[model samples]
Target chain A: MPETPTIPDSPATAPLLRLSGLEQVFDTKRGKVPAVSGVDLKVEAGKVLCLVGESGCGKTTTARAAAGLTRPTGGSVEYLGHDIHRMGAAEWQEYREAVQYIHQDPYASLNPVRTVLSSLTAGLRKHKKVKGRHEARQAAARLLEQVELTPAESYLDKYPHQLSGGQRQRVAVARALAMNPKLLIADESTSMLDVSIRVSLLNTLGGLRDDLGVGFMFITHDLAVAKYFAWDGEIAVMYLGKVVEHGPTPQVINDPQHPYTKALIAAVCEPDPRLARSKKTIPLRSAEIPSLTALPSGCTFHPRCPLAESGDCDTTPPTLAPLDERRRLACHVVARDHVAAQAGTG
Target chain B: MSEEPILSVRDLRITYQTGRNSEVVAARDVEFDLYPGQSMALVGESGCGKTTLGLGLLRLLPKLGRIPQGEIVYRRKDGTTADILKMGKEELRRFRWSEAAMVFQGAMNAFNPVQRIGAHFADTLKDHLPEGKRLSKTEIRERSEELLRMVRLEPGRVLPSFPHELSGGMKQRALIALALALNPQVLVLDEPTTALDLLTQCSIVEELHRLRAEFGFTMIFITHDLGLAAELADRVSTMYAGRIIETGTAEDIFYDPRHPYTSGLINAVLPVVGDLPQLASIPGSPPSLATLPAGCAFGPRCEYVQDRCREAVPALEPLTDRPDGLTHATACLRAEDVQHSREVVSRA
Candidate 1:
């Protein structure tokens, strides 16, 4: 599983990760905490984007500024079209081995005294991508049989407290597919498993994004697992750290044009008891989420939205744009009701 | 709703010890009832003993847990009853929080981080008074500012702050206003809106459905979220390697589940509404309550397992008999061939 490094077939034009106007901020002795502010996104190659929101909504600072792990106090992450904070150390070691990440506590991200073949062959023998210890134990048993954890020689000498939070998140997605990465981010990787091992670790990460083309960003706060692993990829949502609804995950989860993505898809909870008592929950005028050092000037969810409008969502902010021709939106009253329903059907 | 029940339980079990001459059973033969304003839920997953049967229904286990065998019974508020494993220590401390209380699964370290949320409501109203009844300090600051303004919080900026100054939905609405300070007629909770934040778990599930329609009590809870047991259950159950295979209502356990581990935890959930269906997941991994499986502790993740499901345990029973008594029940030994192959695959 290592010898496939030829990669630059180029033509499908650039996006194997981009972020743009990203911002991050921090400082915090109770001050400059803007935790991600502009956040545009893209991913392509084997699509999927997800991100969704909630807990201090920055979706882990826009996935640690798209996994160049932090550094974005303001915009730009890019990756394949350069600028991973201005690359060059061999293009920042090919954007750090084609970008990888994974983390959301597979019990505090692996390494409980290592093992699963020394954490999948220590980044394929520190990026030489295998040359010894028998081809790094056959590329760590083909990454524990590509995360299904089959008889990969009974999980190559076990450990991380002998596995099972869905086999330590399939050995943290086989240590992020031993760096053949081309984008993976993950954060909250199957939110600490067990809904029958979170649908077989999301069908082994939707079979590594359809048999290894890979690209994903994924992060989640479970909009039913970002509508089942980005149903045909794309969904954005976020909140105080901006991207209020971007589209195509079945039209941002079936027509959500943002009142905070229809109050996070009407605050979720549906495993069905007549769709959890015939759904419809919207309600928020304030269950209180503000304070990123007192946010709420323009639309940081206009003091708990429910159709906001106090002087156009309290003096401006909206900015996501495009509401149709496949989604986008950020809400000044749903872009004035999609421009008065396209001026009443033109 | 033929009245009477307010907590019943029965052939319970519990156990724990795990050493010198071992011991494990973590909840077994557990039965149930509840009735008075009932809610139920329990659902399973995480070492499914549903928090050791919600801390063995209030005798709150821990210390190598115990319970041992059966009965819980309950029913007090003067219409007497008893059992909670033969009471005593001051009748289980005045029948716990004035007759069944709980709320616990992490309201960020369930209070006492250097007290002050009005001294955890004046030390749970000065150690659950009534024996020489006392209260004072402006009748405990007007009953802890009327239980933090009945969970809408604000009590003069949360009774002089401190449990790390509020938020995680104000310490789960001040731990459901200190588990409704002694107004208990049963509450339990555990994983109450687990680690808050889907709009603070939808305003703490709409402040527990408006505090169970303005205080009607009898709740239970324990979760592993099946969409919060289909949004705050009206009876549900499920549990796995720690026994209860199924029990119903919440539309017979989410539209007729007859336990192939509650239809593989309702087709492994992921439906934030519509399309993208095919799910699967229940293939082995939930047996160990110390090497269980030899008889349906969800027999190796039963996709309708048989061979008399490893020849033994399968009791839960019922399956129908409702006229609103809410029965359903399941356990399974091919629960009528998995409800006749789920009514011939949902009638094709």
Candidate 2:
């Protein structure tokens, strides 16, 4: 059994950001809707903490709340032991400068009319951190250089349209780096991209984390990218606004404990037709995922849970428990006594 | 494997006159056969002529274009062929949906937003079914309900609801239901599930399987995601630049990909299942059709590219030989060498 990770025993030293019981409710037309509930997450000073899930799973909403783009209805988002939601004016500016967001669409997020150099140096100049135009341009060039857009001078004058998809994404990364941020929240950054280019972009991100000890909150739906993404950090898998399963990347991805996680793995396209055939396809359980507006009475996944059909699941959501020394999952089906009794090995 | 195909197209070329001085070769000598009950995927990146090929077959190519070369030979039931390109717009209209139809990429926008989904079914039936021999409005409603039910959506709720009221997946299902209303023998779907989320994508794939079983109609499903293609296609045809570079069974494409471009696509995909595998994405961009290199278009990025690959375009041919004589084909010069080459020394 894997031991629970404590703040002092963190691989990189200590947790830089500690979030617990983050509940976000929105006033929908129907009623007050909880977009995110019972979410606990943490990121160390120089580790990548990927918040991965399907769309409407509240991963993006959680990211928004982290970046201070969305207001949290409840819960605390702590960075270096400071609650960002309740930060003061000057502190908010500091958070804004340190926590940068890289949205999915690189083109739309950027100012089309503005030049790349201007976009890069604008943040530095706005914060009044740099002295003159030449100095800002120098800093911009260095930032672009870090992102591997070598010959940064050539890229500086070009508009977003003048660049390729990969180059445009690089520029977006460079612009975010210009802020000299401590953390980057990339939300579905490469989902709407060509496959060939996506690999190099992921490599570039890994380079940033290693070469520069920048903390990253890398959010994506693709689990495969996470495994070989050069991230040596833990993972958190969200489902319908809750962290259902999470732990070391290897454990969560390879030996997934939760039923939803199992479904996600089984659904992955196998290169070998034989393996794909043998693995039972997680049956198409529902045409539409149960609405977030009116979640099921007990555990959020119970309605879709195959285990629930066996009367093994109920309304009382299971607490996150350690199944092994390195991993933990929040699912009633993975309880030790239940498994031991069923297997007749205890 | 059939005596006659429902849709047989050969060397069909369609070039868009971009401006007075330049012409974009949208599709170059594309050829394929869609037999009854057989589906083929038209896979490629954006601007690779997959859409142009579909439009040319439907006689719905933009006003600035026409089929400049080749024959779009659709073998009809009466043992005759219909030259779709040569047909008049009215004749083409008469054949639309009833004989062949399209289920477009984003079904939400394709649906009439203001109108209910039921009315779309009514409009399709009225437009296609023989005027003299037709079902009543009541019968049409019953059929529309059945179509909605087939896609797993509540017929009653979906029929009365407007497009916006339905989710993207629901709207796509509704659109597919409308397409089936005509009972066409072939479906030309372009990126039907590309726009939806993964959970939704799974359901849509299920819907696609159900659709294939319910109606043994041939399909020319077009998309850029080969992962989705691996799940959906009966036979996969990979398109690059402006041509179909490879064609084979799903197993052949996934396990033993022959084309460099196809392999690159497969390698680039991140493991979608449990903990994701490291994706080894290729590091270059797809070439522009307007200014592709003289020889092999993929030569620039291919690892095993040869000297001849630079000067001569290698037409797609059958794989050299599967030891047990498996059936697969590729359009690359080094396909045989690639087939024999193992992916990696497995640690296990």
Candidate 3:
């Protein structure tokens, strides 16, 4: 039951962004659509935090609200000390400049007719950071070189169509890096590219975090990519626009506390035939996807919980109870270790 | 393993119209044979023509694609060979699904959402079945329920529900049930579980395996996941840029890969759990079909590429002294050298 969550004092390590109980709702014809609800997020300096979920799970809305693009219906996004929901147009522009958002579909993110050089220098010229044409060209070349688009001259002269899918994405990343932003919100940036180029792009993200000390909020549906990208940062698992579970990466993946988390872990494909990892797939059809307009009662995932019965999940939303100092899971099964133990030794 | 071949496709060629003067050779001079009571996999990357080959076997290539150069000889049980390519439109339509059925990857669009799952089976059964063996309503329900049970779903639950009521996996199973309605001579499943998750993928694939075993139907499983292919298929074939680079047993394909593309792919997929040995991948993407190289396609990205490789494209030559040497082939001039290097690496 969500009686009252203890508001703890902030940790000593300076977290760049801290969000608590953020909710984004849309007034649709059917009803109010709560796209993002009760999401608590924390990202530290130089760390890459990944918010992973399937499509339409409110992960995108949370990122938009944090960047001060979408105003929240409830809760607050605390950027250091200031609440982003209360920021004005000028303040929001400053925040938008600082927190750059890189989107999926690099082909669509870039202008079809524009030259790569022009796209890169637009932000620099708009901000009045660079002087004239020669200086802009030099800066553009520098940014392109930083992203490993070799020689820099080859990419600058070409259009989006002239470049490969991977090259186009590199240019997009270069355009984002031009502003020297604080936090990077990459929403499924590499999902559109071919399988072979995904790892190399992720390696670049890892390199950027280490070299520039820029906090990255990398979002993806592929768990394998997420595991490879963010090794140490906490992973926040979202379900129906709520932060269902959040903890250390290794803990949540290896020994998932929540039922939804367990299902996600079980879903990772097992290649080896003799070792049957695919056997325990728990009939995913039971989870009735809640319509955003008509939200489910109590916990959003409660209707689909394999362990849930009639009144247990219908009336109560479990609190994020402390399983340990670094781990917490909001599930009734987790609260009682005895019940989980029986199911654990399967 | 069979003395009698059920379906034999020889020298098949399929190309896509990339531009006004250019054509993308989707499947180039491919050849394979599928017999009864066995499973074969066509594994490759996204645009590698595995699906094209699957559709080609049924003479179902998309618009602007045609089998300009080969014969698909399906030897019927009564000793009559039906050359599918030579068939007219009416003959092609008659033999297509009832003779060899396919289950697509996504089931949402594959099925009519407004119709009940039970109605789909009824349509197929009524169209094919003769009037002499006309069944009652209860008997039809029993048969439909039995089909659902074979795929490990409740017949009543799936029968009454619309397509939207079922999950991705369940809908796929229902499609499988529809495919088996006529009990065709062979079954072709095209990337059947691509969109589904790992667990759901396994459940659906396991159902396919069980059904194939119980019904004793021949299968041509098409997929991109090497690990999934290795698990499901008895024999594996890997394709790259519209060409079959390797065909062998699952062990030979996964444990001992001949093509650089196949090896690179196996090396890249991150293993889910445990202390798996480290994997190395190929650096660059698959080369464009429009501007293919003069010689070998993989030579640009291959570490083992030599001076002779750039001169002439090497044909697939089988290991002479090996068992079923005629059946196994690799398109490399220095197959002996590649084999030797692979063996040394394995030992190390």
Candidate 4:
């Protein structure tokens, strides 16, 4: 087992970003549909909090809400202990500059008509006042260098179409770093790049934690990447729109408490022939994810939960609560089984 | 060991004519054999020509693309073998779905939205059926329902519904069912579950595993994911810059890769077990087929590269160090040194 990454445990130091009971509802033609509901999470300075789930699980919606790209219908997002949604105009502008967002499609996010230097300096000139135009150009070159786009001088003049997918993503990161953000909300940022290039981009993101003291809310559907990149951080497994399990990365991954987490782990395609050929448990619980508009009556996952019982799992919705010092799980069956095992032993 | 292969490819080179005088070598000197009831995986990143190779086997290359050289020998159902690249128009059409079928990449959304789900399968069945053995509508519908049930879907619920009514995973399964409607001897799937959720992908792959055994068909699973390839394929081929850099049994390719490109690919994937190890990413992008280097295509990014490596391209040769009876081959000059270093690192 890998050693768990050391995290900041003291309560005295306030969190960099805190999301309390965050809820988002979209008004469809049918009715009010809930995309995200009653979620709580936090990220300290230079720490990572990975949000993982299948599509339509509200992971992307939550990231957008945190980045202030999409406004939530309920609850508050507190930045540095202040509600960012309720900030004044000047403060809101500053908050926008402090929290940067990196989207999934690097090709679509960048302006195809503009050169690399023009795009970087355009955003930089808007936020910060430079001594002269030459200084802004120099800063743009430095930003490219920071992302390891070598010679920086050659890349400044090239269009986005000329660069490879991985290089284009590096430029996207450089564009975000121009603002010097304290928080980064990356939503599937490395999904478009090749497998060989994803790790390099991940290392670049990892460098930001040590070099710039930036907290990250890394959102992805891939659990292996969630475990590898955020090894020392926290991982929260979301089902439907709620986090079914949240804990330290190693604890949550290795000894997962919730059935959904267990199913996800079992489903991962390991790069081993013996394991693939052997008869292992598949945990193929359901045909597909249930529609969010007409969610199940009790736990959103009960319809697909193999270990779910009749009366309790269908009637009562479980709340996310600490099961042990290491993790928190939102599953009635697991909690009941834990209590029963303790009673039998003690 | 001397039995004829179901499909044999030798020295296959496919090129795309760009303009008046320029050409892009989409695939070059590719070679492999697919035995009956065996699953082979062709893996590489985007633009590495794995898809083009799959298309070449089916003789479905685009207008600009043509096979400049090589032979794709396919064993027909009547126990005779013929080169797929040389078949006439009518013969090619007859050989397409009945002998081999392809489930295209992102085929989940490839359905005609206006048609019912049952109609899609019926259309495929109708097109491929022999002229004298045409089936009635009721029989086609029954066979379609049976195929749907084979993929673990409800025939009653899904048959009457339009393509829009089904979920993405259901649509993908429906496409697979359509591909298997004719019961082709060889089934080629291009990134079948690339964009699906983890559990959904697992279930679909599990279904494929079950069906492959039940139907006894050879499979060609193509994707950029080495992990998914490891799970489904008995033999794996790693492609780089329009050529097969390594080919071996899944166990050999995963545990004891010889080529630097193959090792770099294996090391790049973030393993789900043990400590989070350092990912060794190959530094440069894939070489452009239009302007390839002097020798090895992967030489620019290879860590163990030497002067001779840049001057001479290494052929894919069998490893003598490996035990006899295993067909493990690599296209790297320093394969011995790399294999020894890997053993040392793993042992320590």
Identify the leading candidate in terms of DockQ.
4
Choose 2 or 4, whichever is better by lDDT: 4
lDDT of 2 by residue, A1-346 (tens): 1324233243244356666677899897898778899777887767888887777888988988888787788877776667777779998888788888898998788899999988998888888979998898899899888988888899888999988878888898998998878888888888767877888888888888887788888888877666666348877888889888888787777677788887776666544444444546676456467778878766778877766644546657677766667666888767654468768954
Provide the lowest-lDDT 10-residue window in model 2 chain A.
Answer: A1-10
- Report the C-alpha displacement of residue B323, candidate 4, in angstroms: 13
Q: Rate the local accuracy (lDDT) of all candidates.
A: 0.81, 0.77, 0.75, 0.85
Please state the Cα-based DockQ of model 2 relative to the true two-chain complex.
Answer: 0.46
Query: How much is B70 displaced in model 1, in angstroms?
Result: 1.8
For model 1, name the residue pairs that clash.
Answer: A23-A75
> In candidate 4 chain B, what residue range of length 10 has the lowest lDDT sum?
B339-348
TM-scores of the candidates, chain A only: 0.39, 0.91, 0.90, 0.94
Assess the local accuracy of residue A209 in candidate 1 as a C-alpha lDDT between 0 and 100: 89
* Candidate 3 accuracy as TM-score: 0.86
Q: Compose the digit string of candidate 1's lDDT tens values, residues A206-248.
A: 8888999898889888888888888888889888788888888
True contacts kept of each: 0.81, 0.52, 0.25, 0.69
Per-candidate chain B TM:
0.38, 0.90, 0.89, 0.93
- Candidate 1: Cα lDDT at B202: 81
Worst 10 residues of 2 chain B by lDDT: B339-348
lDDT of candidate 3 over B1-348, digit per residue (tens) = 656678888888887776777677888878777777768889887777899989888877778777788888998778799888898876776676667888876776789889999998887666656334576777778889888987778987899999998877788888998888777878888988777644566577768777887888888989876667866887778888788888777666666677666667766665545423344546777777777777877888888888888887666655433332225667776655653112211100
Residue A35, candidate 4: Cα error in Å is: 0.9
Better of 2 and 4 by DockQ: 4
